[model samples]
Target chain A: MIFKIAWRNIWRSKLRSFTVMGSVIIGVWSLSFMLAFFAGFIEAYVSSAIENDLSHIQLHHPDFKKDKEVQYRLKDIEAIEKQVTSLDAVKAYTVRSLNNGMLATATGSRGVQIRGVLPEKEAAITNLDQKITTGVYFDATQKRNPILVSKRLAEKLNLSLKSKVVLTFQQANGALTSAAFKIIGLYQTGNAIFENLNVYIRQEDLSRLMGETAMIHELALLLNKKDAIEATQHYLSQHNDSTQVLVENYQQISPDVNLYESQMSVATYIMIVIIMLALIFGIINTMLMAVLERTRELGMLMAVGMNRSKVFLMIILETILLGVIAAPIGLVLGFLTNAYFGSYGIDLSSYSEGMEKFGLSDVVYTHMQTADYLLIMIAVAITAILGALYPAFKAIRLKPVEAIRKI
Target chain B: MKEVIKVQAIKKTYNAESIPVHALRGVDLSIQQGEFTALVGPSGSGKTTLLNIIGGLDAATEGSVLIDQQNISQLTDSQLIDFRKEHIGFVFQAYNLIPVLTAKENVEFVMLLQGKSQAERDARVKDLLGAVGLSEQIDRRPNQLSGGQQQRVAVARALASKPKFVLADEPTANLDSKSTADLLDIMAKLNREENITFLFSTHDQRVIDRAQRIVTLEDGAIISDEQNAIGS
Candidate 1:
């Protein structure tokens, strides 16, 4: 009977009830959309970092990451590559010989990290071949040492495709060396900071130039599934000499990526709290008005035998019914918005320059986990209950005699 | 006849701390079973206050109210609500039927609160609405019914719990002459046929003319208590 009465009572003032429900719908829609957008932004940032350079996992000579000297090369290059490539989880892998040195042209000299990579394997892992904008990737027909420089770096060096540049670095004996290489390709990764600091060259040419045969310093691997990364890294660790190797994933290699990933949920929680708080006050206001308007009716109910607890429960049921009617509509609206944007992403190309500086893609697709939807439903329920408390209590506190006598 | 209501030196003071308004002063009254009694007085003469105290809707400032030998003044507020549900029925002046419920539902509400099964409540609601001449208006809500029909529904609801007695405070104050006459005929018929006890606080001479006994008040004190041999 209470349920029936409460359900009918809300419709007594249809305008007021709908106004409260409209607030709930808008609150739920905005919260869900905002969280989806935040999730998309963070996903873009992390994936861009990984796809551009991080890969799923990377293995380095124990001391090589500390200093990019030629002397810290992997002890047995062939043996380690053989074991890593044989793992069932290994989707693709690449070996690179790294050297931090200076690049010079007739105009100026700038600091650079020269990455010596095998063309086929690097293409498979990082898709470096597709990033070429003007010239071809390292071709077997090239007669000289072929190098790939970013467009931003080429502008700094006053060089273009087929321009000759001199790379100056160190040998295993601590002697300084310089070699001339031809820039065969100019690539633009949209990340100005990374583009300005790094250039790629053929591994054979760099190894021969440093007076070592088959010398490699880093092994970057892309796994078939992200969840298999820790297991693959563990397998690689057991196969190799642990004292000479350090295997790490993208999060381990970049602390900022890890921080962004962990903070996504915190950001979502803050959004839920903010939206629910606003909804709470709106619901309380509406319910308080309902209770006050029906003072005589409530008093009569008590006078005729309805207890305080049942009256309290009836008010609570009314508030919850409002949420129950509004939440699903809001959820459906949010789901539709997410679906439309997810399939055809929202473009923010106008902010591309700024976004790329932080290694984030210009377009972000809105998406949310199933658990997120469940959390939102639970949050709305709690908010409704909390919002109903003061008004329900006020109703139960009215003395039947005084209330009935109220004129 | 057994005494259904016994009021012993009941006193009620409103705004007692500052400029106290004594609504009831040492009023004593006893009503027996199967009696149709009217408490009549001018404005501020303590008719409603005395009735409220006896019905357990308000606490007496001094003295006690016993309904069928139970001291209602000693009960807690929550306990008083339960006592009202189980023993006393009320018919308000404005026809205080739940606006959201149909006539039948309003009659069945108290029985539901009593935890009566559907079969029992349905049967009682059907029988009581028939008794009140609302047998055809069972599905209409209060707002849809006429003022007289609404009062009829209130009377049905008051009897739904089959309480020991019914308290009506000016139940015909809002009705037209025809509605008031029709209502008095129903109440008088019910008292005669069902032997139900009824106590009313009213200024309407129509109600006073039909009562078996009349209790009049002046200056918050009962000035006359008389039984009409043939109702005026």
Candidate 2:
């Protein structure tokens, strides 16, 4: 019966009730969309970093990370490659002979990290073949000493497809060697920083030029499932000698990615709290007006044997019912909005140049976990209850004798 | 006959700290069961104040009120609410039926507070609304009913808990003469049939004419208490 009275009381002022509900609906919908958009933004950034620069895990000669000397090559390259192939979690793996060197074109010269990679293996892991916009992959060219340079780097060095560039670097024997290589492919990964710093050439050409037959400086692995990364890293770490081979996950390789990933949860909670705080004030204002306007009726209720607790409960119930009725509608609307944007994606091509500097993709697909949706609903319920407290307290504070006499 | 209410020299002063205005000054009164009594006075004569004191709606500054042998002045605020719920019913001049509820629900409201079962509440609501001659308007909300009909609903709601007595303050003030007469006829029939005691604070001669006993006050003190042969 208390519930019935409360329900009817809310409808007594239909406009007021709708106004409060409308605010709640808008708050929930906007909050959900904002969270999903941010999640998509972060997802694009982290995934781009992984795909372009850091695979799920990387293995290097322990000293090669601190100093990029060609002498600090893998101790047992064949054994590591065998172990990598045996793991069911490994989707693709590439061995690279990395050298920090200078690439000189006739027009200009720039510092670059020359990555010696097996074309088919590297393509399988990074999908480098699909990213080629103007030139074909290495398999299509019959030229010797073929190279792949990022479109950004090619432009910076005033070189294009079929252009010859000279790469000068240190050999295993401490001799500085320079080789002329022809660029067979130009690719754009939408990561301006990575594109500007690194260039890829065949492992055979790099090894032969470095005065060694098989010089493996880095081994990168991509996993079928991200959840398998930790276990695979642990398994490789257990099998290998830690002193010789340093096995590191993507997060350990790039601390900035880790920071962004860790801060995602905190950022989501902060956004929700900020939005709910605004909604709490709105709900409190509306409920206070409702309570104040019904002063005489509330007094009559108290005089007719309705206790303070029941009166308090009635007001609380009314406030909560408003949220409960509006939250699901907002959730559905938010879901539909997200689903629509997730399918088509939100185009940010106009900001692509600025976004690429931060390693984020231009088109972002909205994404949120099911758990986050549930958490948002719980947040709104708590906001409504918190919003009801002051008004409910004011209601229970009324002196029945005086309230009854109030006009 | 059993004495249903006993007021012992009750005094009520408004704003005692700054400019003391005495609404009730050491007034004492008693009424037995089944008595149709009116506390009559002009403005500022303490009739409503005395009725409020008797109804446990206001506390006296210096005296105690015993209703059916329980000293209500000693009860806590929460206990007083429970006490009033069980023992007192009130009808105000403006007809304070809950506006959101239908006429039948307003009468059933008190019984709901009493934790009465649905069957019990339904039976009593039917009987009481019928007793008030509002059986046909049971489904209508207070706003849908006439002023007279709303007052009748308030009367039915007041008697829903079967209180020791009903306190009515100017119940006929907003009603037409025909509505007032119809309301008085209903109260008189209830008084005669069920022996329910009634106490009223009023300035209307029609109510004074219908009361078996009239207590008139002047300057916060009672000047006369008389029994009328016409009402008896």
Q: Candidate 2: which docking quality band?
A: medium
Give candidate 1 misplaced runs (Cα > 4 Å).
Answer: A156-158
Per-prediction count of colliding residue pairs? 0, 0
Off by over 4 Å in 2: none
Query: Tens digits of per-residue lDDT for model 1 on A107-217?
Result: 999999999999999999988899999898987898768899998788877899889999998876778889999999998876677788889999998888888777788
> What does candidate 1's lDDT look like per residue over B106-189, in tens digits?
999999999999999999999999988988999999999999999989998999999999999999999999999999989998
Q: After superposition, how far is residue B77 of candidate 2 from its true place, in Å?
A: 1.3
Q: What TM-score, over all chains together, does every model reach? A: 0.96, 0.97
**Which pairs of residues collide in model 1?**
none
lDDT score for candidate 1 against the true structure: 0.91
Two-chain DockQ for each candidate model: 0.88, 0.76
Q: Estimate, for each residue in A179-298, the C-alpha lDDT of model 2 and write its tens digit.
A: 999888899999999999999888898999999978999999999999999999999999999989999999999999999999999999999999999999999999999999888888
Instruction: Mark the 10 consecutive residues where model 2 chain B has the least summed lDDT.
Output: B48-57
Q: After superposition, how far is residue A298 of candidate 1 from its true place, in Å?
A: 1.2
Evaluate residue A157 in candidate 2 and report its C-alpha lDDT on the 0 to 100 scale: 81
